[model samples]
Target: MSEMMTRENLTGLYVITDTTRFQRAALVESVSEAIAGGARVVQYRDKSDDVARRREEAAALAELCRRHGRSFIVNDDVALAIEVGADGVHLGRDDAPLTETRARFAAEGLDAIIGVSCYADRLRAERAAAEGADYLAFGAMFPSPTKPHAPGAPAEVLGWARERLGRPVCGIGGITATNVRDLMAHRPDMIAVISEVFAAPDIRAAAEALCHAMAADNTESIQTTEDPETS
Candidate 1:
């Protein structure tokens, strides 16, 4: 196993790729721009059945993330993640069981950073935490263009998970720079975005704006929580 990705490494902007938005070359270029603009984590989320192409793209992304020293995760494909040596894998409800995936990683001598999608279910988040998920993701924080039908999760869930689950929490779906401050009120460790960054005219600029927004919010949150008298 390479360096294990701890919960501490799960912070900041997390960008998810949309195959519908970009082809292979464009995908690589756009992701490079995102990383350059301070995306700490990148997830390859192709749902197509093209095994060879998926593998190729995932391998390319894994290498790109490795070069940049950013965490790379594969969505819902343990085999592909293992093949590409990804730092982690993200599991949705329909995906493989977390324990089985962890066993597979152990068998392969990889300390996979597995993240579980809890949607709006607190019980499900608790279960995932108990089952050893490295992080918990909740959303459709807003109406997601990419997954419009995805279940809507309230921003409060992000705070709840961070307090109770003892793992990093990610807010995903439809989060953009404009409304990110609203989500930031819940203080999510990371925000997972798709179309908001990748669909923009300038991917790097969009990513940078989001990162800057998040940082500003975090600064405000810390200051608000601190005791001025103590200072």
Candidate 2:
């Protein structure tokens, strides 16, 4: 694994938001606070069909992430990501094929930080890695009300992916500071959360707390030079 895709560099929390009832300015303010508190990545995942608004929001978040030196990912929308000059794009199982996405990113001269939602099972993750996915996502670990449509992934899947896949692995769905440490035993490359950070009473504090806990528990993977986290 490369340094940019390592777990240590991304040991902190990642926040994803669709539509917050809060005003856009307030949402941006909260996001800024979260970044200051140690959010490594922020993904804008609006499912709305409004192209102009999507482009605008993507641009705004891209600028915010740029200023904070954090990565910005556009979820499930390659065209919008291109329009906003986003740092990366995330794909679901039903989205475009990995080869097509890679080719698109290559054409643009971008690094193509493509993340694949593997849902569950090592087979999917292994396939994604073999196909050149930048990161592999596993879970719905706990019951994720945010994505009830997602299939549940076993806790052991993280360990399997850790041992089997060379690509960075991210555990998502209902991931909180309390349960996140359990995943450390698996040595996944990253953890992705929705309500745990975004829906918290204090987004900034929540993000920082998660980062601190993961940092402490991730000592082994991050400290060992041979571990990909230290790569």
Model 2: residues >4 Å from true position, as ranges? 1-11, 220-231
Q: How far is candidate 1 from the true structure (C-alpha RMSD, Å)?
A: 5.0
Deviation from truth (RMSD, Å), model 2:
5.2
lDDT for each candidate structure: 0.89, 0.77
Give the worst 10-residue stretch by lDDT in candidate 2: 1-10
Off by over 4 Å in 1: 1-5, 222-231
User: On a 0 to 1 TM-score scale, where does candidate 1 land against the true structure?
Assistant: 0.93
What does candidate 1's lDDT look like per residue over 1-231, in tens digits?
136455578999999997888868888999999999999999999989999889989999998988888899999999899998899899999998999999999999888899999999888998999999999999999999988898898887787778777899999988999999988877899999999899999999999999999988875442133233421
User: Per-residue CA lDDT of candidate 2, range 1-231, in tens?
Assistant: 112433334445777864654336666777787788788888888887777767777788888887777778889988788777776789997899988998887887766588889988566777889898878888988888797877788767777676667677789987889988877767877888878877888888998889888888886442222344422
- Each prediction's TM-score versus the true structure: 0.93, 0.87
Residue pairs in candidate 2 whose N, alpha carbon or C atoms collide under 3 angstroms: none
